[model samples]
Structures are given as structure tokens and as C-alpha cells.
Target: MKPKPPTHITVFAKADGAAPTYWECPSCGFLSGDARFLDTEHPCPECGAVGVERRRFPSDRVRRLDERIRSYQKQGDGEIVVILVMTLLETILEDILDRMMDAHGGDLPLRRMIMDSQRSIGVRIGKLFPALAGEEFEEAAAELGYRDFPKHWRTMREARNAFIHDSPFGGPRERLDARMGEDAMVLLDQAYRLFVLLNNRFVADGHTRS
Candidate 1:
């Protein structure tokens, strides 16, 4: 069966200050910050579609938080680094899901209500994300060269929970050390690229949003 087209598309406009500019391909949903993409005629790296219209990606808040996390990591604040990196990763996941919803013609209130009903990260990733993206999250991650991302993310989450909750029966299983913090930083870097790939595969197709 044929799919419907996207009802609306997101476009990028010029912004002030040090914030980066982003562009999204109208044809394939490939997004990039390169100035060359803003030109009238450019081939999409993913789909090879010509003269694709590129829209701006609205990610100012996410960018700011990412910068803050990087700054803290440099100071040897392992605890903060681990916690913040997890938060950032989750935030990116949320953003991607939101875009996916938007691609499906889901309104803001509906998206909020649906998301609010499923607050657990495990449910969101294991069930909700796959249902929306039309494939399992782990499969997508693996295809995108992030085969270990899910496991590593889960491990970090366990460490963060252990540190925060300090289980009554077992006590804290382990301390979030510098090594974990370093791992978090690496994941943080990878998350953006992976999310973008996911977006292109699932959300960037113009049919999804329609």
C-alpha cells in the first residue's frame, strides 16, 4: 500500500550567537550543519536526491546542554559527567521520537500525552521506539555501527541508578568512576550521529510526517 506524504516540514532559519546552523533534506531527511547544504542545488548524501530543500534543525537547548556536559567532564567530575551524559542521551532520544511523531502527523498534545503514559526509558526504547520506527532499537543501533550502544547505555544506567538509589539490600553496587565517565563521554558523541541516522531512515522520508 502507498503511504501518505508529510503534512508539514521543518525548516532552518538563521540564528544569532555561537549556536550552530543545521539543515535537513526535504527529500530524504538527511540533516547537516554544513553551509554548503544551504545552497539552492545540492545532492543529499543519503538518498542522492538533487536540489533538496534543507530545513534548519531546532536544537539550541540540546546544544547548550551538550556543551555544559563537555565542560564538566573536563573537570574530572565523574559523577556529574555520568549523570548528565545519561540525561543528554535520553534527551536526544526524546527529540528523535518527537520528530518521528511529527513525521507521523502526531500533534504536540497527543505526543505529550502518549509519552507521559510511558515514562520508563526501557519501555520507550525497547517497545515504543521500535513500534514507531518500524524496527527494533537494538537492530537499528547495530546497523548504524552502534551494536554495543544499547548494552553500554544500560550498564551506565544501572551504575547511575545504583549510585543514586544505593539499594538497601545490596548497597551501592559500584561507584561511578573516571572510567565510566570517559565511557559516558564517548557515548555522548556517538548518540548524535546514531540519532541522525535513525532520523534519516525513519523520520526523514517525507511520507512519514504526512
Candidate 2:
């Protein structure tokens, strides 16, 4: 069957030279990273303004971000599944960290949680291969340039910030749902790709013939 046309969410992009930051909410004065949830009556959380309209436009660096956003609006089962799977993984990881912190009588900050995962995996690898040691892989990733890891992290964080701050995007629940779902999928997919890139590097480093 022919696919349905994608609904274009109104994305407001910053100037071209700047990073794709801050989506303006259409409903209210709220400006945030994600505008998927704002509608007219809801008003802007930031300024209590009403009857605003949201329009989103991403930069070239964030062009791919719109692909899945459009896909979700088109209601593609495959894209939905991909997004759900990645969200599940994130939830599981968070649970594991929570349990570990409970056992240790401490909490893991967001940055620490990400760093610990890499370090834990690296430790296991080091034990099996005496040549590689602590922090070496991280250093290599920093030096040789691992793609998407940090970029996706930033993107996801930005989206979350936009959602929380009640950017002007606040609006009717139905419209917001469509926007939120799209933004969530895009942000998660970006993270998933980064994780995959890191995993691929891990596999390649460990699979040496020597």
C-alpha cells in the first residue's frame, strides 16, 4: 500500500549558523527543546500566554531528526517498534543503576551513569585481554573521534529540557501527543545509533587476530 503523507510539525529553528536549539511553543510563551505537546488552550508554561501556534524547523545538522518525527506521524509500525525498544533499553539500564545505587547507598548522577557503563564494560574486556587497561578505550574514543555518542546525548538532553520547561509548544493534548511521540522517537533513535557505534567499536577492538 502507498504510505500516507507525513504531518509536518511546525518546527521553529534558530538562525542557520547557530546549533538547532530551542523550539518555540505555539500555545504560550514557553520556549523549549521539544514542542510536540503544545496546543492553543494549554497556553505557554513560561509566560501563561494563550492561543499561540508552534512551528518547528531543524538545522542541517539535525535534518535526520525530522525523518523519524515524520515517520511517527505517518504511523509506521516499524518505527514505533524501534522507538519502543530503545526506550525499553533505557528503562532497564536506569533500573539496573537504581538497584546498584541502592546497594551502595548512593545515587549515580546522569553523567556518572553514562561513564560507569563504559567503564564497567571496559573492565571486563581488560580482564580478558591483558593489553588493554582502564580508561584506554575512553581515551581512544576521545582522540580518534567516535561518532554520535556525545552528539546524541546532547540532543536527547535538549529534547527533555524542552519538554520539562513547558516551552510555548504547550497545547491540546492530542496535538502534543503527536509532537511528543515524534520528538521522543527522534531523540531515542539518535541515542540508539550512538550506542551502536560504541558497541561496534568494542567488538572491533576485541576481535583482533593477535
Candidate 3:
């Protein structure tokens, strides 16, 4: 099953020791991650509304799932690690897309509708992201110093799919090796940083200013 509109995430904090906190406007559902104005004393940048709630971006549920994945990694179960990390990555992508839509003033229903209509990750990254951010996902990632992230993510997804699905033309992949598992771990770490950058740029940019 695919997700939106929903999603492990469990991102760590920067060297400064503050886990990035996403503050959402209860009034309009606008989200922001600007360190300068994380405190809710400022008005909602989108609607000038007060009382923006502080929400940990990964949320508690995601953190719990992350713990399970880490345990699996510790056990050296490469196949399971690959599958779970792939699922987690997709979930994170969907959420970031939703967050970007929210930043652009899309309400819950509207965001849901958009995500529901466009379920393909390739399409979401190739088309939807540009429509919202005025730049290609690869281009954006390049600017953010993860120039190869999208390509690497796509390659990993293909590996995961080959292992999971049976192909009429070619047999399904039988196993995911330790190398793939390690790659997933690397991507997982990179994902947190990439996600934070995207959130800071798209969800918490000028839209949340008082």
C-alpha cells in the first residue's frame, strides 16, 4: 500500500544539538521550521494566526518504527532491512510532498486529493515537486548537496521491487545482500538530512514568517 499524505523517520538533530522542531499553525495548518521563529510568539506566516503547535516532524510513531528497523539492522537481516527501509523512504517522501502542499496553502482535503491522484513516486518527484517548488527534484537535491540522492533512491527502490515482485519476463530477485542493506542504512541517514533541508525550504520558509 502507498502513503501520502502520511508516513519512520526519526531524524537526529544538527551538531548544535537541537532536533529540528516543526511548528504548525493550528489556525491554518501552515508549517514552519525556521530556527529564528520556532517559538510560537510570532504569528502564523500564512494567516497571521497565533498558537502554532510544536510538532516533532518524525512524530512518536515514526520513532518507534525506526527503533524496530535499527534492531533489524543490528541483527544483520539484510533482506528485512532493505524492505523496511524502502517502505520508510517512500512514506517520508509522501509526507514531504504533503508538507510542501500545506506550505503553499493547501488544506487537508485538497492535499489528500492531490496525493491520491498522483500515487507514483517517480511522478511525484518529477512532476508534482516542480509544480510546487518551480524546480526539478533532482535539481533541488543537487542544490542541497545531495546531487545523487534521487538517483540512488531510485536504484534502491528498483532493487527492493525486484526482490519483492515476480516478473513474467525475468525471475524475481532471490535475496538482498548485506551491501544493499548497508546502502539502505546510508540512505536512511541521508534522508533525515535531505528531509530537513526540504522542510526548511518548502514548509518553513517565508510562508511562516510573522
lDDT of every predicted structure (CA atoms): 0.74, 0.38, 0.72
Please provide, for model 3 over 78-145, each residue's C-alpha lDDT reduced to its tens digit, 9 standing for 90 to 100. 89988988888888889888877876878999999999999988898889988877788888789778
* lDDT (Cα, tens digit) per residue for candidate 2, span 43-126: 443444566665442234344444444455567443343344334435423333333233233435743664456544233323
Top candidate, metric TM-score:
1
Which runs in model 3 stand beyond 4 Å of their true positions? 1-53
What is the Cα-based lDDT of residue 144 in candidate 2? 34
Q: Name the lDDT value of residue 134 in candidate 2.
A: 30
Off by over 4 Å in 1: 1-22, 26-29, 43-58, 206-210
| 15-88 per-residue lDDT for model 1 (tens digits) | 43223457777765667656777885766655566665677764778778877877777788889889988987
TM-score per model over all chains? 0.79, 0.26, 0.77
**Which model is ahead, 2 or 3, in terms of TM-score?**
3
Q: What TM-score does candidate 1 reach? A: 0.79
